[model samples]
Target: MILRSPYPDVEIPEVPLPEFLFGAGFGDRGDAAAFIDGATGSSVTFDELTGMVTRIAAALHERGLRRGDVVALFAPNSPAWVAVFQGVLRANGIVTSANSLYSPAELAHQLTDSGATMLVTVSPFLDRATAAAAQAGLPDDAVVTLDPVDGRTSLVDLLGSSATPPELEVGPGDTAVLPYSSGTTGLAKGVVLTHRNLVANLLQFTPLGTTDETTRILAVLPFFHIYGMTVMMNHGLHRRATVVTMPRFDMAEFLRVVAEYRLNRLYIAPPVAVALAKHPLVDEHDLSCVDVIFSGAAPLDAELGHAVARRLGCVVLQGYGMTELSPVSHSMDERHPDDDLNGVGYAIPNVESKLVDPETGREVGPGERGELWVRGPNVMSGYLNNPSATAATLDADGFLHTGDVATVDERGFFRIVDRVKELIKYKGYQVPPAELEAVLLTHPGIADAAVIGVSDAEGEEVPKAFVVVQEGVTLTADDVMAFVAERLAPYKKVRVVEFLDAIPKSASGKILRKDLRARENA
Candidate 1:
């Protein structure tokens, strides 16, 4: 029982991302501010942005970057990041964006695995970026910072190049960006997204009528994440909306930027909804400019969604996606203000979805819980260099098995109930239990470790570690937590630690996560 989107299918253009974005029908928007720096109030007009992209592309080309060559972008959300991103595309090169919070080791893993030829980062992150570059065998000259610094190649230097922009060497089917994801299990793998995958997604949501030239979007979420990359950055550009970039989330700064910029459209994760609903500082700002707050990347509590709507006098909505789906498969449109906020609204145009029982491999009808399988132009090509992982997720039928258990109504609205995947969502970031468990095993005092998602006091999912200390070794819960924290990103830190004599396992040696979950519930 395959469920098709309720909306009419949108026609996707067979153009490269750069051509789709910067090529045609943008003359009128040339004078409009394309992106603004939230803190500095600095901006670049559409014309200026295109010019920078041209210059950056020319510089990268002159510096020997070629088609299919990968460049790793390791930075936070900023207007400059957007330029460099599109710049790489314009240069006919691939980009693999790394999480801003990644430790040197984590960043190096991505750099080495992605086969990135060059690394782009900011001055503040030079320590980790340089260390990661060295570990990945990247030369010092390969490190290019967004901001100018002494003895470092900077974006300003790139923009100074007088060479002509290279011809479009990539087409719709060519790989454009490689964003890492811990799909169903195991370590992070690069999800191959093509130019068409991006362009199709941009067009697929056109019926939503959410943002346009009149919209002012607050981009507080990290642009490296797919939610921010597609929904906020590219979508905003496609619709000619002014996007304001925030380097990082600071409560006061976020509010000030929203109010100052008179931003009306906001795309956020569930955790931000918690702040918007209960944080007293939210009352301090005149957020009347905000008309919609759309949450994605994780589930939003219905009560929390309503609370935020009540507090902000705005419509609250939720969407669903995975990196393997080019990030968005279903989303609540602004037109459907009456739709239930809990269910991720109708499947976006051009998407066909199915709910299949994992055990039986049988398709489930409406109202039955099953693993979601989606097929669309926006679906990823596959995982980079891992055909087995790709085959396990995307079947021969073209359906990408999402591993998330969901149920659909007769009307085609889907609600996520549970997940078959071992991946944990910690504050909307992917915290793979396998990754954390592997890190924990490196601790000298730990003999064995198992990590699982547990609800914190705030009802947020956090990674909880159950450790079995080696004989004659002394270890505290704090010690276990600290060991994992030092090796991983901040969001991947083990919040709760419990010492266990032995981790329950099946005869096949698989960790009995269900038993650990039952223990947590008990």
Candidate 2:
């Protein structure tokens, strides 16, 4: 059964991302504060942002960056990062955004795989960036710092060039950004997002957000991630909203900035929602200004989502997406503030989705769980230089197999169950880890938890949980087991419990389940 967006399709303009963003409709707010540094309160006006982008483009073009060349942005979230990102696109170059938390080796892997010719970073990260650049065989001169550093090329140097911005040579089909993702499974590979992919998602998502010139968006998530890149950075720019950028997420600092700036719209991952719902620090701040809290990058428990909504007295929304779909295919429309918080509401404009049985390769109707296949202009073209992986994911009909199990209702509301590969089979019964994780999170003693399939002494596969107990709460393994047992089926009960100080997560806020499996094997 194919499901189309409930909303009318918005026309996608056949223009490059830079042209579409800086041209008629999106860029007219000249002097408005486009971005603000949460820590310093410095602002970048729309005009100033455009000017910086122009100068940076001119400088990069003068320094040998050409069409199809790849530039690696390894810096944290900042106005300068935005400038460089747009600048590279303006110069007809592709951008590969690297996670700011990447180690030298990890960064090197991306730099090498993406075939990045130059790297842009800040002074603090210069050591690792330089090491990775060297490992990737990038020349020393190819490393540019966003902040001024003696003996290094800096943003100041880039903007000081007198050369004019190069002519825009790319079209809508040209590559824009390469954000790495593990897709359904396996190692992280670059997902080739074109100008049309980015721009189409922007148009498709804009109607559902309710953002305008007056909206204040808190961008605490890393901009390197596709969720932050497309949803927060580009969408904010497209909507002319004031985006407050934070280099890192600290609970105290996050609360302070939101309260201080009176930020209304918050884009966050599920992990941050935990703090808002349970952390004592949240109550210390005046969060009445918050209007909506949007969560993505992972499935959020409905119980926890309600807790956050009740505590903040704001509308809580959740969406479903993956990096390959230009990050957003479904979202809860702001118009329906009372929509079920558990389901990611209707598909956005121009998006078509299908719930197909993975085992049977048959279409499934509403209320049946199946793998989600999304087709839209926003769907990524394919993985870079990985044809086998691309063929395995994106079909000839243009539907990208998301590999996530989902169910849709009669009203077209979609609920994500879990990854097809992550489901636990106990005694021939299927148990979804997300369901058990949601149940585990409801326990008052549990702060955070992750469910994974582990082999038992009898060689049978069963569900095991890695939990983080709430601080100052005394909870035992049996108590945890009983808490879930009373709430779930026998097969769905967490059979093993291990306490940890924290759960490992990526910069995008996805739980590192592989790390947990490796630890179990070790």
Best by TM-score: 2
Q: Which residue pairs clash within candidate 1?
A: none
The alpha-carbon deviation from the true structure for residue 202 of candidate 1, after best TM-score superposition, in angstroms, is 0.5
Give me candidate 2's TM-score against the actual structure. 0.98
Give the alpha carbon lDDT tens digit for every residue of 472-492 in model 2.
999999999999999887778
Task: Name the top lDDT candidate.
Answer: 2
TM-score of each: 0.83, 0.98
Worst 10 residues of 2 by lDDT: 179-188
Estimate every model's Cα lDDT from 0 to 1. Answer: 0.87, 0.92
Q: Write the per-residue lDDT of candidate 1 for residues 1-522, one digit (tens) a residue.
A: 889999999999899999999888477889999999998989999999999999999999999999999999999888999999999999999999998878899899999999999999998999999999999999999999999999988999999999998998999999999999832244779999999999999898878756889999989887887878998999999999999999887789999999989999998866566567666799899999999998887666676778789999999888888788878899887886888876888899999999999879999999887899999999999999999988998999999998888889988989876567767887788676756775675565666678889998999999999998877889888888877778888998999999899887522133667788889879
| Candidate 1 deviation (Cα RMSD) | 10.2
